[model samples]
Target: TPTTIPYVYAAEEDRCAPRHDVLIPSRMRFTGSTSFSVNVFNISLAGFACDALLQIHRGTRCWLTLPGLGALEASVVHHNNEGLGCAFENMLNPAVLDRYVAHYPVPETEELEA
Candidate 1:
């Protein structure tokens, strides 16, 4: 199996957020209930990335519903053939995101631990 990167991808300026694909539903509710199947490509302290079939225009506001994380308000920061980058505008529960991150733990080795 391929190893997963723990850190979120970022540009040099760290302005735009990065993304990834989880193929899981980041259930969203903006105009209505839309379940989008996406993989979280990257994540930062601010936002994350996911494969979106919908063309997410810049500055578009949407809600994200994680499996256990509940819902969060997010905005489209960037989009391309890869996916849409979104920044968390309002988190229904911060702990939800926290727990999700914690669930995907990167193994610690002696050299890395040192």
Candidate 2:
């Protein structure tokens, strides 16, 4: 089993609203309104650590897409009062991940893991 890595970072003073996107996957069930709040936090070459406000249970398989990055499949690996944590089902888009890394460079040390 892939190890679940806890995201380690400081919460921004401003809520830094997460970008929302509509997702339509044929494999998954959905109602009239289907969307999820995606937080792009602590992104790395391996994967990104995000918190999602989704009505999905753990182990649920779904596809995710960001503004610059295209759609990719993912599985629900973690869920808590905070939100959901999912390891990208595949290696992240390197180009997109690189851009994010350039923008939100990791600090010298990891902040308290959330």
Candidate 1 residues lying further than 4 Å off, grouped into runs, are: 1-13, 16-25, 91-98, 105-114
Scored by CA lDDT, what does every candidate get? 0.58, 0.47
Worst 10 residues of 2 by lDDT: 21-30
Best by TM-score: 1
Q: Could you give candidate 1's per-residue lDDT for residues 1-114 as a string of tens digits?
A: 987532222331364433322234456555565666665645545676677756867668877766766567777777788777777774224454455666643335522653
Error of 1 at 14 (Å): 3.1
> Per-residue alpha-carbon lDDT of model 2 for 31-98, expressed as tens digits?
33465556555444433446565556655666666655556666665566655545555656566655
Q: So what's the TM-score on candidate 2?
A: 0.52
Candidate 2 achieves a global lDDT of 0.47
Off by over 4 Å in 2: 1-33, 104-114
